[model samples]
Structure formats: structure tokens, C-alpha cells
Target: MKAGRFEQAQRQHIATLVRLGEGREALAGREIIQRSWRRCVDDYRLDPSRPRPVRVLTHEALVDSREPVDELLYVARAGVDQLFAQVAPMGYVLLLTDRHGVTVDFRGHPDQDAALRRAGLYLGADWDERHAGTCAVGTCIHEARALTCHQREHFDATHIALTCTAAPIHDPQGRPIAVLDISALQSPRGLESQSFGLPLVTLYARMIEDAYFLHRYRDTTILRFDTTRAFVHFNGRGLLAFDPQGRVLAANGEGRALIDAHAQRTPPAPTQVTQLFEAELDDLLALPRCEPDQLRALRLRASGEIRFAALVEPRGVRSRQRDAAATDAVTDIATGATTASHDPVATTSTPDLDRLAGDDPAMQRLLGLARRLCRQPLNVLIRGETGTGKEVLARALHASGDRAEGPFIAVNCAAIPESLIESELFGYLPGAFTGGNPKGMRGLIPQADGGTLFLDEIGDMPLTLQSRLLRVLAEQEVMPLGAERPVKVALRVVTATHRDLAALIAEGRFREDLYYRLNGAELVLPPLRERADRRYLIQRLFAALAAEQDGAVQLRADALHALLDAPWPGNVRQLKSALAFALATREGETVTVHDLPESCRAGLVSAPPLASTSATSEAARVRRESDDALADPEGLALARTLAQASWNVSQVARQLGISRPTLYRRMRRHGLIPPNRREALRG
Candidate 1:
């Protein structure tokens, strides 16, 4: 019988008992047959067509099979021994089988083993339907499901001494793969023994299936859920639900939180999907389904919460063929949603400014200036040390500004060859050079029309091209090499340079006029050393990198401190390299200080420590005294001003003159805060 059909048959049998008013009496037979069927299927991989026969196979004939019978026998014998040694009080016989439906492996206690073998129930026996009709392993295999049998339920009269439970193991793709069975000699206690072991056998089968699936479908999304709707799956974005018709059904914890606060206040009742998004859904579904690139915001009816969602239908002839081959392969689950339009001022045209990572006041100031400049079409000059993220800041400005909808074409001036710089920048006509394309090319400036053009390493731009670049900026037109006509270009230029352009101009290496043109609104980025939050950078880098490595590694406390104290000459780039190297060499959970590269290790050891114990103790005392004296408002203001001026007596005197002495007296009178002259302060 087929597995599905067997289940149907069992259900029918149970219904008949209930209808006959013998439901309670039928339980015994039901349990017995279920256990016996499962055991026969699991033990011999059999089917109903070839059920166990009336006569049992002799031990010698069973052992004579050349098929992988010895391995099965060994495991069965071992299992039986273990059952007797540990579960002897329970008293159960272990049964095993080969890939085929044959009882190649079996075991029992020494006393029971001898008696069972003599009774034609021991090793080398074939319990398949061919030999014993409607048996455990054989029938279950045929049904491709679990089964059980109870005492007196044997197909053959010679098999009256046993009861069994069995289950079939499936491969990752749900094919009936293997069988496991357990049997016990008949006892006066009835079918309870087989019933008790049914779930255990079933659980083992499930474990094997799970492992197989995990391996086979490694790329597919896997979801795990707890009783109360918590997500326990790995690499999951969020919990989501979809109706049979593919409508948004529900969302997980984090998704619900993202809805507008007002929307969350009046959420829909349980099992109710918000109707507010009906119009939006209709519009989305109405749009041409040919291309799925366009995504729109979905707003909830009850809570006014909004989410971004896109529909993706399989594309291409190949995809259709694959879909036909595996109709059930694709799951129509709602993948996830991100917050939509949270800030009215922020738009798609606005560059993703917030992507830049830093908390320094200088960086904040630069960002503020970038935001303001984004609204106007003005040239921007980004000045910073190499690897200090100048280009990142420039991209942010473009993304946050009004022209964000325009293209962002970035060209590294230093990387391009000097000879090709002009052609590359201004483009060329067909056959403009020896190997140039016959068709004229659009220059970078023309290509960047109606968008932002980022010129990185602008300082390295050859002096000859500087004048031509200035002309383009001045005229808003680019004349391609060998092209007769000048192309009118509208572009916003954002240039970055590590070298001091003003210094270069003074040295006659850069054009003075071009420098002024590119420096329309200069934003200088401070180096990592100037940022006080080195500790924050270390922690962020470590956490971000560790997440990328999955569970491969982590950094120890000492290693993190070493990272913080070391002067990052290469800034973030150097830090990332060191972390990556350390993680690669790490043997266990944590990366020790010694795991760092030789350069980083040397830098950490060579650097002067932040503050010695004695210095910290003294500084602490000074802070206490300062805090005590600044209790009064007037005294506090004066103390702050003095501290701001670094407590320089001459500068203090110049600001507060004859009153300086008197202010000094007053400060003493008010317990003036003393300054620590040891540490230098940057203005």
C-alpha cells in the first residue's frame, strides 16, 4: 500500500470501530497493528504486495545472503547487547536490516538470543512481505511511513513471540531512503512495549531528514519559529507572512515595530490584516508585471505603518521550464520589508549620507556643511588625508542634496595616465588618436551632465590639463579631442585631494586659478588621530568584521585595547587589514594580542600608554578640585573660560587685564581650579 493510502486505510478502520460502538475495544488492535506494521516496514523495507509469509526463514539461509548483511548483523548484535546491559530491566530485542528488506542484523540477551534463534526468529532472517506478509519493516517501506505491531498481530503463526515498531528514513528530497526497526519478544504486558517506542523511532527518522535537508538546501531560506512567534532561524531578515492569494498577511516583531508609532497605537485585531494598503496593493498589481524592478511603499490601514515591497515573478524561458520541473520548489513567502520614507526631507535622489561612519565633531561639522551645499549647485572641494574617507563624504553630500537624482561619476585623477588624462576627461572623436575608436566618445564632464562628478586625487591632475579643466568649469562646455563642436555640459564637480592644493599652487606645481575654482566650498576632514573616540572605532570595526566571519572569531579585551592605543597611520584601511589577518590566524574563539600582525604589534608596544596610573590619579584629584571650585555660577563661568584658554596667565591677563589679578584673587578666594600643564590641548 502507498503511504498516503495506508494512512487513509488506518483512519477508515478507526472510523469503523467508532461507528460500531467498539471504539474503546478497537484501541488494543489498532495499537498492535500499527506497531507491527511499522516494524515490518522499517526492518525489511517491504510492501503490502509482498507481505511476510506463513513460514519463517531458517537462520542459515538468512545468514547466507551475500549482500551487506554482516554490517547490519554487527549493529543489531551491538544494539541488543547495549539494550540488555543498560535497558535489561525493560527487556527489549534490537532489530536491524540492510538497505534491502532483509533481517540481516538482530540481537537479544544471551539467554533470549539462543532461545529466539532456536525458535526461528534470530539473525539472518528475512521479515519482508515475501517471507512474512504484512510485517513491520516490509509493509512500512511499501507504505513509506512509520508503523507498529503488537503481540498476536504477527502475519505468521510462527512469529507469535514478538511485537515491533519501525520507521522509514528519507533523503533530503523526501524519498524513502532507509529503515530502522526495534522488536521485542512477546510478554504478558500486551502491545505497550511497541507503542512506547513508536515516537522514538519516528524522532530518529525526522533527525536524519532534517540533517539531509539542511545539507542539500543550504542556499534556500530556512525559518524556525517558537510557539509565541519569535524567529529562531539563522540569516533571517525578519518574520513575514503571506496569504494563499499572495497578499500581505502578517509581520514579525521587528517588522511590527517599524510601523509608525501612531499606526502601532491602533493596530488591527488578531488575524486581521490592515486594509489601508488595499489601494496601493491594487496599483502595484495593476502595473505591468513584465519588469519587477519598481518597488512601492505599502501603508497599513489600521496603524498607518508603511513598508516597501516589490513583486518578483520568475523571468525568462529557462526559468519557466525550471518552475515547471519543480512546481513546489519555490515558496511564496514574504521575504522582508524595510522602513519607507521615514524622513520627508530625505529622498531617493539624496545620496546615502548617513553611510559615512564617524562621530567626531569635525566630521559632524563637515556633514552639516555638505547637507547645506546639497540644496545648491555649487562646486565642492573635499580636503583630507589619504584613507580618511574624503570620497565617502563627497558621495554623502551628493546623495543628500537636490541633485541626488543625477549621476555620480567618480574619476580617480591619480590613477589615470597623464597622456590620456585629457582625452579621458574631455572624451575624443572617432580616430582622434592612433587606436582611438572611430566613433566620437563623450567626455567625463559631458557624461556627468545633470549629475555630480567626483574627481578623486585632484592634486595629481597634470598641470597642463588643469587649465583646460578650469576652462570647462568656467564655460560649462567640453570640446572633445578632434571634435569640431563643443558640447554644453551641466555638472556639479566635487574634488578631493590629500596634498595641500594651496601649498602646491604657491610652489608653482598647481594652477592658482584652478585651485580657487575647485575650492568654492572646501570641507576639511580631520584625521583619525584627531578623533577622541578611537575606542568606538575599534569596537565598531571588531563587531562588524566578526559578524562578517559568522562564528569564526572574536577579539580579546587586550587585543581591542591594543587596537585603540595604536596610531592608525593608514586609518580604517590598516585597521581592517590587521583584523582580517588576526581572524585568519586565530585558532579558537578569541583573538589574542599576539595574533595581531608584526607591524601592529610593534606599534602597540612602541606607543606611549594613554595615561600612567600616577598621572590618572593626579588628574582625578585635579578634576575633583576643579569641580568643587566651580559650584557657583560666576566662578564656574570664569573657570570654564580660563580652562578654555588653557589657564595661560598671559592670555588670561590679556583678556581680563588688571581685573586679571583681581580675578585671580577672586578665583583663589573662590578656590580657583588649577590647570594640568602636562598634557597639550589642540585648539
Candidate 2:
């Protein structure tokens, strides 16, 4: 084979660009053109000084050719094929060229086949720099940079109808391996040609670079950064890079958003790549790094603004000294125990309490209060609707308390049989009752001696047991049946009840004195219906449960809407059960509306309109139903009196012909408890 006049000219042009730079940049340009040139030069085994001989680089030649030049050309052609197929719907063509800029593969619309072939724009077409100067494929290859040329940008008048963008794809060593070009018919009025064509070309080039890097350097970390390191090019979401000194270096788009929210302020720059390197250095130097079994995320205040970050030290470097110190600090912070030394783990591995995963203000406040309250041994009383997770709050309290290492005994007072309630709580002595143990057993109160005792449905306890419970709580001791002496116990008591204790007291069903003792420190857990955090709860529940289940079972948009609209009489418990049921019923991938249980689906359906003859009749019908659902005589009297009395409970009670206690009880029953007072009602 021999080289043509155009091929000789292109080689000269590429050689000129290589002389203008030095080292990596210069080498990069030379490698790109040399790889492309080798495809033709080696395939025909020709000298460039001779006249050019043409041959199409088929996929078979690429796969079967033992030569590296043939393999590279084969890969380039394959990539061009894929790019053309991907963007074919947008009416674009993909072209691949040799180092001398001759078209090796031209992929595009079949409708333009005749026109393109006639214009010498098909495979084996001569597009060397000499023949097509300043064009996308030729100029980008000649300049060793990405270029976009549209319509009249072509030096050859015959190529005026095309808008093309070409980017030089580089290998891991920063050598240009091939040029990726996307060309479309010139669109004089639309922006799609420029926007889609240019971006698509850039993307294809990046994909090639990424694939090459991953293949060549499998062991080394290949961190891909955008112009700024604000968004890393990989799939990991919200990844934030931290320095050894605990400074934030760079954050991905999602990570930046989280950091901004935590900090409650925006960063000065949109993206800063240098910050990432600096932070990496600081992170590496902070302490002896160790890989964590699970990466604990941390959010801290920097420059008076909070930012989210994670410490990811490689595995096997964590020493016992580091682990002990870190564990001690975390335990102290969580349990309100003695402060531990400022170890690296203490400083770097603390979990972000702010990111505990809920969006409701009430939930946020509850978490904040839980964090502060965890440091103490105060008895807590959580009052909420039945399915509102009284137990979850109790567990959180226990886990966050000093006695987390000790037992957490939870007893449901209402679930226990009346005859067994006393024995179950206070334990029993040998021969104290029929079938009694030979040796006296420790009761729940004693079992929870070093930790927390969660008494659920305390209001439902029989009056006889209430007095005994009050005695145990007041004396901090319990006397088992047939025991001669009381056993002293050290434990925190947390009680929950769905019933109104004051109403029980007024009915003479509960002891008033006992109520005050248990209400020492109250925390009212809001019912799901009343909680503003339903959306947050849904997200957290899905995230927590989805990982355990087999297939994809995300809530449908309609399901989420339905969940938000439904009155959750069963609260959090019902929500979890509903999701479980939906997951079980999911046919293929998604949890559709049809997968929901009848009860949930029914709840989702809008209630039917009441029959009416006239417009006024319909309005009255609607109002009547609304009142029936939300306003009884007790609620109406309370609402009216509160409105008239200027929202003062005591004044409203006096005006509403009820005692203050009676008014409060009715307000709670009617779900009229004010947001502020609801916290008070927790006790």
C-alpha cells in the first residue's frame, strides 16, 4: 500500500501539534494519532511515503487480528457502532477516523445512505486533514482536543449540511486512543443538535476512558472528577471526601446538598477540586486508620455550619487502643456516663444523629430531646395511640442510656393475665403459689434492676397492682410473694399507655397518687395520624426493610399518596404491616396499588358523597359528616368554648360547664390537644 497526498499532509499537521507541547500533554497527543495511524499503516503494512491503499476495518478483522493495531481499531469501530445505535432516534451519525483522519467507519440513518455514499461520506471515505481541513473529526484529531463544528464550520463546501462534535478518547496513561464523533443534519432552528450531539459525544469519550482505566489499573484508585470535584464520575451517591484532620475536602452533588443542609449554609464555591486533595491528606494523617465493619457517618460543625462526612479508613489498621478509646467515648456520649479520652474513633466515627432519617419536625424534636435526655436516669412515660411505637421509643431510650449494657425488660401490663400480673411483675417465692418454683425467681422489676423496665399499658393494670407498683416505684424496691424482705433495685422505669389515666382516676378505676408517681418524666409519642412525619416515617421504613426483602418492592407514587391521605388508626405498626403485606403480594418488581391489602386499599379510596337534593342540602350533608367524624358534643363544646374563651383551657373549661380536668380529658379524647400541651400530656 502507498500513502496519498492528503494522508501525507495530515501526518505533517499532527506532527506539528506534538512539537508545541512537552512531556505528558505532548506524549498524549502523539500517542492518540500514532494509535490511529497504526491501524491503517499496520493493516496494509504500507509506508506512508507511498500512495494510500483503502480497506474497511471490519468487526471480524478487529476480533481475529493478532496485531495490537488491528485490535485497537476493532474496539474503536465497535464503540462507534454502539454510539450511533444509541443516538439513532435523534437522527445522528457516528464516525471513526484513523490518525490521518480518514473515515474508517460511518454509522447513521439508512434514509441518508444514498446521499452520504454519493458525497463520499461512507466507510473508506478519505477525510484526512488535507482533504477536510478544520472539520470536527479531522481538526479534533489534528489538534488533539475535543471540537464541535456545525454547518458552515467545515472547510469543504460539500460537508455543509452536517453538525458534528468529536472528542479524543484517551487511554489510562493519558494517550488519545481514538476520536468519537457524532454528526447530525444541520438544524437551523432547534437546540437539540448542539445540546444532545455535543454532550453525547463527550459522554461516549468518557465511557471509553473509564473502561480503559478500569481495565489497565485494576488495583489503583481511579477517582474521576468533573471539572470541579463536586461530583465524582462514579455511581456512588453523596460521597464526601474528608481529610485526616477532619476537614471536608470535596463532596459529590448529593453529598454537597446534605452538607449544605446540615451546615444550614451554602459553601462559597460550587465545586473545589483542591479541597478534596487537601482533605484526603488531613484524613490520612489524623490517626492510625482502620477499616470499619460498617462506615459510621458523622455530621459536625465546621466554621459554625454543620456538614455531613464519613471516615472510611481501610480495614486491619484499627488497633485495640483506638477501638477502646473510640468505644468508650461513644458509650459515654450515648449513656451519659463518664467522658472518654478524645480518641480518633471518638472524633471520627461518631454516627450522625441528625441523619437518623426522618423529616417531621416533631420527630426531629423528639430525637433532639432523646439525645439530651439519654444522659440521665429519669423515669419516662410515653403516651400515644396503640400502634404509635411506644416500644420503639423505649428501646431508643434504653440504647441511648447509661444502662445500655444491662438488660432492657419490657412487660405489657394489659397483655398479662390478671391472676399472673402480680407474679409476673414481682416474681414468686418457692411454694408461694401452686406450681411455684422451688427457688424464688426474679420478677421483671428485679430483672431490669441494672437497666430499663418498659411497662406498656400501665393504665390497664388492675387497681390492686397499681398500688403495689406505686409502692415499688416509690421505695425503689420489690417484695416477691412469700418473701420476708424487700429487694432493692436500681433501674429506670418507662411506662406507656393508650388509655386516659385521668379518666380512669375520675372513674375510680385508677389510683390518682399512682398516676403522679409514674408521670414523673413524661414523653408523649404522637400517633401516626397526628404526626407530621408520616412521609419521613415511610422513607425510613422502606430503607430499613427493603434491604432484608428479596425483590424490589418500593411504594408506588399512588401508594405513597394513599398512605399520606389515610387516617392511620393503627399508626406505625399498621404502616409496617401494610408494607410487609404489599411486599409479599408483589408480582414481579414494583409494589403496585393492587398489591395493597383490602383494608389499606379501602382506606385509600375516597368516601362516597352523601345523597342530597339541593346545593344547600349537599353542603349540610358534607358538614354533618365532617362534624360526626371530628366533632362530638364534647369536642364541639370544647372547640366553641375555647374559641370564645380566647384559647385558654382553664377559662374555656369554666365557660364550657366542665371541670378543668374534665375539659382536658375531653380535649385529648377529641384529638384537640394543642401541639405544646401534647408534650405535657406525655406524662
Q: For every model in order, what is the number of clashing pairs?
A: 40, 15
lDDT of 1 by residue, 115-202 (tens): 5664445555565654564556766776677887554455444444556777775543345555667666655566664566788767
> How well does candidate 1 match the true structure in TM-score terms?
0.39
Q: How accurate is candidate 2 locally (lDDT)?
A: 0.56
Per-prediction CA RMSD (Å): 30.8, 30.1
Assess every candidate by TM-score.
0.39, 0.42
Could you give candidate 2's per-residue lDDT for residues 72-116 as a string of tens digits? Answer: 343343456678788778777777655555564568678899766
